[model samples]
Target: MTAPSAIEVQDLVKTYAVRGRPPVRALDGVSFDAPSGAVLGLLGPNGAGKSTTLKILTTLTRPDAGSARVAGVDVVARPAEVRRRIGYVAQRPVTDPMDTGRENLVLAGRLQGLGARAARARADELLERFDLGAAADRLVRTYSGGMARKLDVAVGLAHRPEVLFLDEPTTGLDPHARAEMWAEIERMTHEERMTVVLTTHYLEEADRLAAHLVIVDHGRVVAGGAPSDLKDALRGDTVVVEVADDGATARAGEVASRVTGLREVTTDGRTVRARTSASSAVVLPALLAALDAADVGVASATLARPSLDDVYLSITGRAFEAGAAAETEEVAA
Candidate 1:
């Protein structure tokens, strides 16, 4: 039998009015599912409606149309119920700097409806579990970035919420800290049996941590599936050759198109892209020799199996970095 859905969303549409400007639609008919005890990655570039979707599901922002249910509780009709069943960890730190690590967890537990004794017990439990037992009594302001992030995650779990919303959880962390958070997320899903809904801009993070992926762009889901399946759907190896000059791009594309195994040949600025059913080794020498014969100077060339970025590019008609840069100047209002 199929696993039950921990969260359900359908055609979620949200629009915000901007003063002296036209209203912006942050979400446009977005929908996806997260199975119970699974990690769902919501991936998109900036202003792609990821944050807006999170706000609606967490009951922080209501959608003008469509429906969402968290842990089987309707976000619109029964927001409080949904809140009780889910833990929301925002992009920024929400812990009190003046409070000790243990104190913050205890307070969060109490707020989640635990008794005083129960709250303290949960705090100690989390401190040990999160490897914060050594610094449990230290002020949060005194802790390192990684330690503070771990504490925030602990506080989110103090109430043993059935579903957790992690929004850019490792955005500012170093590689080590990011890996630590990834492990914690895995523990939450496997050992603790909680469903996680993750929203992140880090392609590597989404590729690594999520059991399933739902990619949203321009306020809509463009692709949804397991990461491996999504990559496999693209077929063949990707060959990218960066020419020495932009002038060589068109010539490079034409040259690559004439190669025996290359297909879907396209040019982007100075790079010529193609896919080959054969291994790169089988075609790289021939491709290069042809480019050299045509006097097209090669800057560099790389062959990689289809990556999440490739899948994203095929579906979105642009590179992830390029798309991400598009919304940097505009707020997702």
Candidate 2:
């Protein structure tokens, strides 16, 4: 039999009011489910209600409408019990610079109701597991950004919660640091069997880490499934043709569409992109020949296996980067 869902959200809605401005609807009937021990990614542009959803799940705030359950407890009805079973690592670092890593962890443990002796043991174990043992005695101020972030995660786990919520855990880390954090997160889920709900703006991070993905836009799920499945559902390779001038793009698209098997021909400036079930070997030659027949100058051409980026473009009719930028601008306004 399948395990019950570790997290379940149904038609969640939330609205925020600002001075002299209309109330903004942050969540509009958002819903998804994640099974136990899975890394579920809430993938979206900035200000797309990803954070708002996280807050509701973690019981930081109540949803204006709908229901949610974490670890089988209703969030609105049993928030205190839900809180006990979950750990939250926010987008910002919460550790105190003046405290050593060990001290910070011990404090977190104590706050979670562990006695002094147990808290110390848990802190030591986590410090070693997260590779912060060498720097355990050093002030958190002296740790690198990666080390500090790891500590932040370790603190969240000090209570040995069943579910962990990570909001943009790798946001500010450098490439190397982000890689290390990813490895640490993998270890947590694989070794400890922890269920993780991760919110991220980084497309590559979600693509690499999530066992299941829920793509949100404008406070609703636009697409969701295993990353590979979502990409596979698009059902074709993508062909991109770059022409010499914007004038050639329309003709290039028209030519590409005429090739049997190619679908969704779209033109952007001097580039034409299409999808085809045929292999690149079969599609490239036919596509090039068709464009050539149309007298469209092909400066370059390439084919790529379907990707999450492509899936986003196809489903949303906008590129991920562009949507992210728009979300950011909306937040600022």
Candidate 3:
């Protein structure tokens, strides 16, 4: 039998009213289920309602309509219970600079009603687990950006919650720190057996971390499934053949089109990429033959399986990098 859903959201609608402008519909009839012990990626570009959806699920804010639940407790009706079972890490860093890392975690646990001893013990354990043991006694103000972010997450997990929500967890993290955070998150997912709902604009993060991927755009789920399944749905392998000059792109596509199993060919500048059923059998040989026949110079050729990035672009007509840029713009504006 299938396991019961750890989190369920149905027809959730949330809108915010600006003082001078019209209300923005953040979540428009959004729906999805996250089963126990699974990582569900809530993916989308900026203004796509990823944060709004998370707010509703964590019971941090009320939805204008519809309903949601965490661990079977109604998000709106039993918000306290929902909080008790979930660990929430917001998109922005939320750490008290006045307190030491250990003190912050201890305070969080005590606020959750744990005994002083238990809270201290939990703080110590998490500090070590998150690689902050040496600096546990240091004030949060003394910590690096990544270290402070780690403390924020540790504080949220003080109660050993069964569900965890990480909103853009690696955002603003340096490359090395981001890798560390990824490892830390992976370890927590396994050790705690927690159901994680991760909202991220990073396509590779979702592809690597989430067991189930859900793509949301403008507050609607446009795609949902396992990463491999979604990639497979796009069909076959992709062969990219780069030509020497700008005029060679169209010529390369024309050549690739005549290839036996190639389904589609697209040319951007001097690069020609094609989706084909048989990269080995029809795509490679036929493309090379055609290029040779046309006297076109082949600089390099690469065959790769489709990635979640390709799938995202195929569905949304926008690249993940573009989405990331838009998110940054929204933040800046």
Sort by lDDT, best first: 1, 2, 3
Q: List per-prediction Cα lDDT, in the order shown.
A: 0.90, 0.88, 0.84
The segments of candidate 2 whose C-alpha lies over 4 angstroms from its true place after superposition are 241-260, 267-272, 289-300, 329-333
Runs with alpha carbons beyond 4 Å of true place in candidate 1: 245-251, 266-270, 277-279, 329-333
The total of clashing pairs for model 2 equals: 0
Per-candidate RMSD, Å? 1.9, 2.6, 3.1
On the 0 to 100 scale, the lDDT of residue 178 in model 1 is 90
**Cα lDDT tens digits for candidate 3, 208-288:** 889888888887888889998999899878788899877778877888888788866767667776777764665687788
Best by lDDT: 1
- Deviating ranges (above 4 Å) for candidate 3: 19-22, 241-260, 264-273, 285-300, 326-333
Sort every candidate by TM-score, greatest first. Answer: 1, 2, 3
What is the lDDT, from 0 to 100, of the residue 117 in candidate 1?
A: 99
What TM-score would each prediction reach against the true structure?
0.94, 0.90, 0.86
Error of 3 at 45 (Å): 1.3
Please give, for residues 228-299, the per-residue lDDT of candidate 1 as tens digits: 999999989999999998888898999999999888787778988888867778898899999999999999
User: Candidate 2 residues 213-289, lDDT tens each?
Assistant: 99988889999999999988988888888998778788788778789878888776687878887776898899998
TM-score of 2: 0.90
Error of 1 at 203 (Å): 2.1
Report the number of the highest-TM-score candidate: 1
